[model samples]
Target: MSKIAQELASASTNTEDFYADLKPFANFEQLTNFDRYLPLPDDWFIGVADVVQSTRAIEIGRYKAVNTVAAAVLVAITNALPRLGFPYVFGGDGATVALPGKYLDDVRYELARTAAWAEDSLGLVLRVTIVPVSEIRAAGHDVRVARYAASENVSYAMFTGGGVAWAETQLKKGEFAIHRAPLDAKPNLSGLYCGFGPIPTEQGVILSIIALPLEDQASYRALVADVLTLIEFSSRRSGHPLPEGGPLPSWLGGEIQRLLSRDSPHANLLTAAADALRAIKTRIVLAAGIRIGRFEPSKYRREMWQNTDFRKFDDGLKMTVDCSPEIAEAIEARLIFAERSGVCLAGTHRQKSAHLTCYVPSNIQSDHVHFVDGADGGYAAAAAKKRRVRLPRGTNGHYRANRSIDAGERPHRD
Candidate 1:
C-alpha cells in the first residue's frame, strides 16, 4: 500500500499527489509516539476535577491508602461519565471529561454536584474551569511524559520523607472548548500547567492540561462514579439524541436566537456565523499528530521553530479558532477530508489571536491548505504523502527568525 501510494505521489501533481508528496515528508510516524503526548478532539464540552491536598496525605503516612482511594475515585468518576452520556479521562489527582453540545449543561451541573460530594466525603478541594472547547484545542503539544516523571522525583526530594507520588492528567480540546484535570498539586510533586494552540495533525488545533497532587488520593476519587455517569450519558446522546424539530433547547439555540431577535451585537455575530457555516461547507479535518508536552510562556519561542506556542512555529499558515460547538463541528468535518488525504495536522501555538486565525501559506494552493514543516519551512502533498520542499517561498514574518513569537510571554491559552 505504501509503495503504491508513494509511486502515485511521485507521479502526479493532483490533490491526491499533494497528499502523496506529503506522505514521505508526512509526520504520521509521530502519532505512534503519543505515549509522550495525546490527541484530543476539539468542540466537545468537558469537565475537570482535582484532589485538594495530596502532599499532606503523603506526610500523614496515608500515601499507600490514599493512592488506593484515589484510584477508586477515578474508577467511579470515569464510570459515572459514561452513564451520564459523556467520556472522561481518569487523571491521577483529578479527571477530565467530554460531552456533546446537547448535554453540556447537564454534564456541567452533574460535575458540580459531584465536586461537592467529593469535597465532603474525600476531604479534597475541587475547582472547575468551564472553558470553551476552542481554548483547550488550541494548546495541544507533545511533552515527554518522561519530563513529568523527572519533575515528580525532584518534587519528592524537596519535600523530604513523604515525596510526591506519581500522578496523571487528562485534557480535551476542540474548536469550542478545552478541559483539564491533574492527579496531584503538591508544590514539589507536580506543577499544574496548561497551554492553548495547535497540535501536529489534520486539525492544526491544540490545548494543554496538567495537574500536581496537593492532597490525599482518597479525595481525588470521591465522586468518580457520578462524574463517569455524566460523561457516558452525554456520549450516548451525541450519537442517539434526536434533533429538536422546531424549538431549540433553552441552554443554547433558543436563548441565542432570542437574544439575536432582540438585536444584541454578540447575538448578531453568532447568528451570522451560524448562517455562514450552514450555508457553506467548511473543510474540517481530524488528524492524529504529535505534541510538545510541557510549556512555559516566558521561555516560549526562544528558538525559531522550537517555540512553545504554535504562533512561533516555522509554519507560514496558522488558524486559531475560538468558536461554539456548532461552529467547531463544521470545521472538524472539513478537516476529516484532509485527514483521509494524509494531511499532517498538528496543534500549534498558544492562541495569539482572540479568534482562531487560519494561517495561509504563500505557497499553499488556494483550494488546498498544506500543513508542513513550520520552523524549517517545507511544502506537503498529503495525497503524495511526502514533504516535498524544505522551505516554501514567502514564509510569514513570524515564520522568520523567532521574532514572531508571542509578545506577552504569558498565555491564557488552556
Candidate 2:
C-alpha cells in the first residue's frame, strides 16, 4: 500500500476520534490546498442518501420540501450518534456522510428509517446506500477529507479524492443499496427545520454553480483559486446569501412539513397547535430582537450568517451565492473560457432569491448550521445543465464523455 494509505489503515484501528483529531482551517479559500485533506481510514464507510427525480419536484415548487427531506438525513444520523463527530455534506436534494465501521449498523438503520419516513410522509423517494472506503479504493478512487471551521462550534467537511463521487454513482445504479425500513419506522429528526422564507436578493440574483476539473489536480486547484479570487474581488461578502440581520420566519414557511415528519401518535391537533405557538414566539423574538433566557436573537442571527454553507467542496466545487447581474455574468464567462480551454466543466443557474434550511440543536447555541440554495432550482438544475454539454479530455488521457459528474450533489457541512 502507499504510505498515506498505510497510515490511514493504522488510524482505522482506533477510529473513535479520527475526525476530531484533525486540525481545522478557518479559511474557506484554502479548500484548494490539497495538503489540508487526509484520506479516510480504510475501514470507514460512506452513506449516501438521494432524492430521486428531484428536478421534477423542484419544477412543481416543492423545492422547500425537497431541501428539508435532504437535510433530515444528516439531522437523523447526528441525533442517533450524538457523541460522535462525522463528516457529511448536504446536497439540495440529498446528503452524504462518512463514519467509522463501528457505527455502520447504527447509521444504516437510521438511514433506512429516514428513507421510509420521507416517502410515507412527504411523498419523496429517498434512495439510501452505504459503501466501504476499501471498496471505493478498490474501484480506483479515494475519499480524502478536510475540516473548514465555519464557526467556533461548527466545522464543515470538504471532500476530495473523488471517492464520494464514485459512491453516489454506484448508489444510483442499484449497487450496495439499502432497503427502506418498515413504513412505520422513524428516525430521530429533532433539530431539522425549514422555517425561514426565501431571502430576496439585495444583489441582482442568486447564482448556483457546480464546476469540475477536466485536467490534473494542480490545474483544478488553480482554477478554483481563481474563481474564489474573482468572487472576493467583487465583494468580500458577495457569496453570503443571507442578509446582515439573518432570515425572518414565514407564517407558512415549514411548520406543516415539520409537523408531518413526526410519526408519533401524539402528532395531532394539540401537537400542531404547540408547534404553531412556538413559531409565533420565534417570529416575535426575531422581529423585536429580544433576548430571552440565554437565547440572544442578535447574536444568533450573526452566527447563522457565518455558519451557512453557501460555498463548499465535495469532490468538486459547488456554491450558491447572491451577486449582481454583472458579477454573475463575469463568473459565467470565466467558467466558459475555462471549459473551452479544457481546464474544467461547469454549470450555473440564476434565480431572484435564495432559500435556507436549518438544523438548530438549540437557539441558545451558536453551533447551528444552515444550508443554502437557489429558491427555484439549485444544484440539481445546475448539474442537469452541465450534463448536456460534451466534456473534454483530462490530462491523464481519459475522455469524460460517458462519465457522469453529478455524483457530488450536496452541500458540505458536517
Question: What local lDDT does model 2 show for residue 385?
Answer: 47
Over 23-75, each residue of candidate 1 has an lDDT whose tens digit, in order, gives: 11122112122132211223344445444454344345432222222333333
In the predicted model 2, the residue pairs found to clash are 90-411, 91-410, 91-411
Instruction: Provide the TM-score for each candidate, comma-separated.
Output: 0.26, 0.92
Model 1 spans > 4 angstroms off: 1-41, 64-87, 137-414
Model 1 residue 221 distance off true place after TM-score fit, in angstroms: 32
Please list the Cα RMSD from the true structure of every candidate, rounded to 1 decimal place.
Answer: 25.5, 3.4
Deviation (Å) of 340 in candidate 2: 1.5
Ten contiguous residues minimizing lDDT sum, candidate 1: 155-164
Instruction: State in Å the error of residue 392, model 2.
Output: 14
In the range 75-173, model 2's lDDT, one tens digit per residue, is 999999988889999888899999989899999999999999888878889999999998987866778888999878789998877677778777888
- The clash count of every prediction, one per candidate, is 138, 3
